[model samples]
Target: MNPVHDHRRLGRELDLFDTDPLMGAGLPYWLPDGAVVRHVLEEYVREVERAAGYRHVYSPVLGKRELYEISGHWDHYSDDMFPPMRLGGGEGEEVVLRPSLCPHHALIYRSRSHSYRELPLRIAELGGMYRSELSGVLGGLTRVRSIQLNDAHIFCTLEQVVEEARAALGLIRRAYDDLGIRASRYRLSLPGDGDGKYVPEPELWRRATALLEEVLDGVEYESVEGEAAFYGPKIDVQITDPAGRESTLSTVQIDFHQPERFDLHYIGPDGGKHRPVMVHRSIIGSVERLVAHLVEAHGGAFPVWLAPVQLVVLPVGDGQEERAHDVVRRAEARGVRAELSGPGHGTLGARVRAARLVPYQAVIGEREADAGCAAVRLRDGRRPGAVPVDELLERIGARDSDRGTELWAAA
Candidate 1:
């Protein structure tokens, strides 16, 4: 990885985010620019999940310790979890910050009974979760104590597992395609033979592993014997960064244990109750990690749709202030994230140089103002000349709408 494009450095240079030692390590403070990028990403993923028939919900970040105990996390994964906080003068139950959202989603699914017709119940949440990470390993947004996951659980019958898994895989593929990222390889993480980290149900493990293998039958994947979660087997989508360093960005996990542990059931068509298999999936994985990846992937120069500032309007002289403001207004009306740089802000040269931080810059001057246009300057040193205001707005609108990665890729 290029250290120059390291997210920690670019985050500071771009005024995107920061971390404070006063607030403890691994906690990020998102500045306005960074918040804009995060909001855009969250909304985009929300729409994607909505289109996929997923019901989004909000859940508390902390839950009673017994909840995780029933979900099997307390027995197998408590070290990574925050210590329990006792409430009510030591008379009440102990609560701990949840390490994941799957158990909470299982509770939501059990809140009401369902019929066999509603076999595939996809519940999603962009939920914030807290985990206890070692101070030595915490660096930038990639590894953090607090994480917001693009997590979802699909509760379906045994017969629907393959189809639901395929649908989940399709979502991951589509998301990666849109972001212009490719996975290096698929990894089927399974339980180790004698590792105490995994649950000890031979038959259940075998069935779940076989089901995942069948679902990914024709797909190419490497079997990772001891990397599975304590609850079940998972397919990890491993992405290789520009520097050739590989990391897991997404996952589709087959969980047969959580449902049974939580006693989640649905009424079958045969008038009998049956346990629904749970498929835990994440499209972009951790939102924070994805942001870090994108920042480094694009070197802090985000695309038109995801960029904090898509276009900067720079006034050549004080005389063009009114015209510059007018251009910003028009661009904003056209759904462009445009800003104006006036005389008092800096010199003309400095303003132009600052505009390099954004994708496109329009230098408005007396000549262009009189002609009802602005001189468009792209970051790649290409000048599209003084284009009409209407045409400029149209170009920007098209790029923003289409989520174009480069301003002049087509040109």
Candidate 2:
């Protein structure tokens, strides 16, 4: 049940995800199926974030070295970032690849001003983030030096902090439940009182931490010390795969500190300029890492909605190839990602075996072509059933809405 190893092997076996040390460790390639699976997740995140009032924004991949300096990453994680280089001529300024989605997002907020009514502003970005993760620590898609973050930043007034946190936690829960992954733990991460340098504002830390704790009351969680973000306490969800490996998939972080460092402010109803509290979050944290998790969690038999090929239409003989092709077109036209498989040089038995490898196989032949029906054999074979194209389309539509369900449709 080593998910890391399981995905590493399953990815290659399914011709989905790939990694090569020569190209540098931690950077994995998403083959056709892997890419499709990831695309589905990305689309899902985009829809959810948009509905949550998150405005999408794009920024440069590289930023001035001073950006990291102002964000304090230079001192905390400088070594974990790409080396900086001078841009333009030698006398020009230096720039480094952005390792996280925050510093740039902070700049986005700093780029504008707003009133108290607009205090709870959310900005989302599905952009690639770069980090200099040690090659030794690299593993398939689970750990990557370069990854895409389905990230968002929330800005709200002090009074709205708890509500904001609650909304974020709910979002994470929705994603976990939809994906069929067990909700391992949704906890309030607070710094230990023992940590000497934890904000000198003990009252602020106490009130903030307690607010988060109160929100989790009656909710499931087990607190852990020293796991809170250095900037603020947070609500984080950790997922435990079937193999028992734990990973943090999403978080709603309370940052009472970064806003000040970045000098972010908003106009209050009192006609006074007030600093807004900022919360950083990522529901699909790192898309690459989450894809890796899903690969192992479902053992490469992706749910119909997330499966790269929802159905592979196979011709029973050379004579039925065109009919199989027609079935493929019909499926794809219905917005189902499907393909046609041939008997090839192998016997019909071999072709059927290969077809089973796909999540769903449509065996089209005299029976299927004449009746205009498909033998929709599921990958696991636990649920074998025939579904007309329209029926399958209806099933696909039902799975598209993730609310309170897993990302991959239930088998």
Candidate 3:
């Protein structure tokens, strides 16, 4: 991998995130710039989910140990889960950092009675979960202990499972397109033969696998064994990093085991109770992993809408500082993530270099500032040149709103 394209190195150079030896491995803290990027991306996800009929929900990161046991995580996935923490005394109540969000989501669905009208209840959350990855294999945000997953669960009748799963895949594709991500391939992740890691219900496994296959009817995918979740089969959207290492970035999983274990059901048209199928889908698996792939893929040059500092106002000299500040203020009022880089930072060239990865660089000088305009430079080395402040903002706003890759809109 090119050092410039490595997220670990780019993270340090870009002041995005950092890991502390004292804080332990696989745990990293986001710097201000990085936080901005994360906040924007998270908002983007929420917007997408909202438009897709997913109701947002909040759940605690820690759950009773019994919760996972009931969800089959404790039995089938405890090796990757944190050790249970007992409260009060050894025999007292035990809790653990959740390894996945589905268990809590299952509890939420069970919290209320539902009719067939709300059969396909989609619940979404940008929530945190933890993994107990060994230190030796941990590196940067790619393999983090704490993860903010773009997770959602759909509870629907068995008949609605295929359509819901198909819609979830469509959502993933839409999100990937907007984020400038290209999936390497689709994978039909199935349980391996005689794998104790999977749930013992052969019927549930077969049914879930068949449903996923139906969901992927026209899509190209490779069926791989031992990659399925313990509860069921899944469609894993894989992406390759700059280093050529492949990883799952997004997924749509059909879980029959959870609904059975949790005894979840809904009132059907026949006025009788029926089991609701659970579909687990993640548009962007983990925020950390997604950002890591983004950093490497874009080489720290994020799309304008996702850029930490969308635009930087650089004053060519001391005379233009006030004008530059005005430009930043106006940009901020318009919700653009703009900042001012003054002469005190060093020469104009140095300031530009510092913000090289920023989407838009607006350079102000005596001439342009006097004329109430700024010379515009794009991160991709396009010099649109001397666009009026209002016009510049309006153009950028259009691009941002569209989530387009173009730095400037067409005339």
Candidate 4:
């Protein structure tokens, strides 16, 4: 990647995140600006999930070793997982940092009995998980040991699996459009012949793979072998970075193995217990990788709604300092992220250049301050002339709410 477009470079320059040698590789800490961006994205995903009938829940990051044993992680995926830590000297219970959220979610579903009335129970969480990634392959946020996953699992009957998966794919597409992410293609990742990474169940694998195919009906996708999950097959949404590297950014999977291993079931109308299918979905994968892609995609200039410092108020001279401060206050009152760049910083032009990535800039001078207006400068270098404080705030709010790429509303 070019230094100008690399997320690692931009992250350092924009004060997004950084890694400390003491903290170990693949572990990066977010700065204030980065935290704001992450917080906004998290809230946005939660709102989308809630509106789509998904119930949010919280789960711990650590799980008992036996949990993964039952969920097949220990048997099939222990290498990529951290070694279990013994609580006591040597004979105490062992716990592990989970490599995936599914096992814990499975436990949550089994906490109580369910009926067919809640067949399509969609559960969502923005949770943390850990991976034992090799240091040689770790770079930036794209490959990290700790991950905050935008993950969900749906427990539904056999009949509801197709529709649920379809809805998940639609949600992913909608989110990408709003986030300014373009997917390269859809990949149907199937298990390769004699691949031991997959669970050892031919009939179960066949059923799961067929069901995913049914869900992908009419969707343009490429079938690739050896990319399926250990427990099931999945549809991977692939994307390319500015550096020409391709990776999966979103995914949908159908797993019958975990449901069977965990003995998950729902009561049918006939009063008989029936096994429920598990559909795994992620709208934007991990928060770290998503932000990395976003940083490179936008070159640190985020959309207005997602930008850390959305608006910066600049005073042309000392005489307009009070006016600039008032503008900042008004913008903040209206729920816009606003800051002030005083004349002491530098020339108005220099200050503007420094904050070039900011979405909006409000420059207050003597004439504009007298008229209770400010010269509006957009990040894209378009001047909207002098706009009244109320009108300026309204326009910014409108663009932000719409999540559109356009800085100003159409006339």
Candidate 5:
């Protein structure tokens, strides 16, 4: 792998994001450019979830200590959690930043009684989660203390487990297909024997493992023992990056313990109350990590749709400045993320070099301005003569709408 294309280097070169000593390590703040990329990715994922029948919700980031205690995280995963803060006076309660969003979703499921018809209720949130990770292990976006998870929970009856799991896997596959990501392999992570961290119910563990196995049948996976989460068994989709390093990018977990521990239930067809199963899944894993992967994968040359600035308009001289600004306004009016750069800022060659990574660049010179058109330059070193303003708008808008990787071919 070329070090120049590494996410850390590209992040600096492109002014994507940064970490400061005063703000602490493992916590990154996104710059304006980085924020645009994040917003685009986030909105895309939200649309995917909406099509999958997920109801989005927002909950408080801090929860009472009793919440984790009841969910068993306080006893099993307290070390990964931040210290609880006491609120109010002597009889005040202690609340801590949430390490995960599962416990909160479970409470949402219980807020109102659900019937058998509402068997497969999916709740999703792109919420912030904090983990007290070791500073030594912290690096660029991949290992961070403050993270945003594309998390969701599906509450359904026992008979619906396989279907829900299949739907979740389909969602992951569709997302990866759209982004051109391929999973290297799949692993069925199971609990190990004599682990004090895991719940000690052998019957529950066996049933959950069996259900997951049924869900993953004929799906080409390796069964790995001792890698399951404390609450249940899971299927992890692993992807190998361009650097030959492997990481889990998506996961589907069948959790039977949490629903029981929290007494989550729904009315069945026979008019009897029955416990509902919960499936925890994340399609993109962490938003920060996904952005890092894409940065390295594309060498900071994002697809036209995902690029922070899809088009950069450069005025060749002072006389063309007004035309350049007008072109920018036209692009923006048509929903394109466009910016104007003047010759005052830098030489024409210098400005073009700086915007070399952008998918499309437009040079508005004297003749082109007089003719009301742009001399379009593509990232692939192709200048396709002067394109009329209306045609330029249509081509760029089509590429953005189609999420094409290259402007010339897309046009």
Candidate 6:
């Protein structure tokens, strides 16, 4: 019913990911081809987060309602959350599907008294979170009830806040650039009086917003008024799809109020207890939405780095099938996702056209195979003729590592 639905249709035609009535909607079943890309992207995010000085932590999918209440999320996030359940008899009788990974991480921090030296502690989680989305608004992976969020939270001292926020913004831009979505613009939202995601103290929220805005000032961003979460102000990155549709592809929100609400604090240099600021950010806000946006932006032809299948080796005849198998084996050995085009049968043109709907790199054939090469083709409609197998692999791998959209300079 929505243009987003049209995007979903393209996803199916390309064999990316899908949803169905049997699964009762909002539950996306990523096909094998789609999973490969999603899995790689998820891992890539994790690697970057770790390199950026964040520690990885795993937590439960469900938490007590009291937890949410204490964090202010229960009051604010209840409607969008899955229904709560009564825990027969627990320390605090409240259980709901985690809408976000913050409160849980905070609880982990409280597990032990933290000192000021550990003030700017960053925790990242690649989690599958569930929420209750109205069925009418659900469309494939874009707006789903169950989704994976590339979520991370940073608890830092006042002094470290600015640099931390700056680092997050950099990561956002780098990720987009890697995915070939560089033309996107970013928006920075600051808190107003009685506004921002509620910081327990007015001055704190005000000061935090100012600090973040100061760091973002030199950076190019469109400034917006009062669009931040109730707990803090934020920076959101958005891009336009082929039809000129704007979507917020990623976000980095800084929170000061929630941590204090949950009694989150660390011993400071003065040996006095002080509140730690919490930052809720997702470089890739929602993986499902990101995938959908990428699908539409590139019209379902992902780049080599992001493509599920990098190459499709097609044999000219049954005799060449052995060579094709060897070529495919070599490609896969080099971390390329390659497959034969229907074994001994199928026209190479038809297969290329079909695979074109997907993002693929090369197609090995009789001539190329005999010559120890593959017919290298770019998703951008360029046939670079037969390239040595090793050359093709190196080109594809290097482009992927460099986040280049194409094998040649234009890509």
* Clashes by residue pair, model 2: 177-405, 178-405, 178-406, 178-407, 179-406, 179-407, 180-406
TM-score of 6: 0.90
Q: List the residue pairs that clash in candidate 4.
A: none
TM-score of each: 0.96, 0.91, 0.98, 0.98, 0.96, 0.90
Q: Model 4, residue 63: what's the lDDT?
A: 95
Please list the C-alpha lDDT of all candidates, in the order they appear.
0.89, 0.77, 0.93, 0.93, 0.89, 0.77
Count of residue pairs whose backbone atoms collide, per candidate: 0, 7, 0, 0, 0, 7
Q: Write the residue-wise lDDT of candidate 1 on 178-229 in tens digits.
A: 7766778999998887346788888888998898999898899999888899
Runs in model 5 lying further than 4 Å from the true structure: 89-91
Candidate 6: global Cα-lDDT?
Answer: 0.77
Q: State the lDDT of candidate 6 residue by residue for 1-411, as single tens digits.
A: 344436688888777787768988789898987898789889889988999999998898998878888888766567788988777765547688988888888898888898999768998998878889998998777789888889998989878878888888889878887887764677877545542234456676677678777778777888777666666778888777676767676777777777777788899889999988887778877888888877877667777778887777766667677877887788788887778785445576777777765444466556776788777776668878887888777776777778776567643
Candidate 1, superposed: residue stretches over 4 Å from native: 406-411
lDDT of 4 by residue, 313-336 (tens): 999999999889988899989989
Clashing pairs in 6: 65-94, 197-230, 197-231, 197-232, 198-230, 198-231, 406-411
Query: How well does candidate 2 score on lDDT at residue 265?
Result: 91
**Of 1 and 6, the candidate ranking higher by TM-score:** 1
lDDT of 6 at 173: 75
For residues 1-411, what per-residue lDDT tens digits would candidate 3 score against the true structure? Answer: 999899999987898999888988899999999998899889999999999999999999999999998999998999999998999998789999999999999999999999999879999999999999998889888998999999999999888999999999998999999999899999999988735798889899889989999999998999998898888889999999988999999999999899999999999999999999999999988999999999999999988888888899999989899989999999999988899999999999999999999888999999999899999998889998898999999988887899999776679
How far is 293's C-alpha from truth in model 1 (Å)?
0.6
Weakest 10 consecutive residues, lDDT, candidate 1? 402-411
Deviating ranges (above 4 Å) for candidate 2: 2-5, 192-204, 382-388, 392-411
lDDT of 2 by residue, 1-411 (tens): 764448878788888877766876777777887888888898888988889888999988899999888876776667778999997889999999998878888889989888998879998999987989876887778778888998888988989888887888788878776776766777677777634435555666676688788778789788887777655677778877667878787887777667878999999989999988887888878988788888877777666677777777777888888888887777777787887778784776676676565666677777777777776665666444565756765565565533322322555
lDDT measured at residue 124 in model 5 versus the true structure, 0 to 100: 95
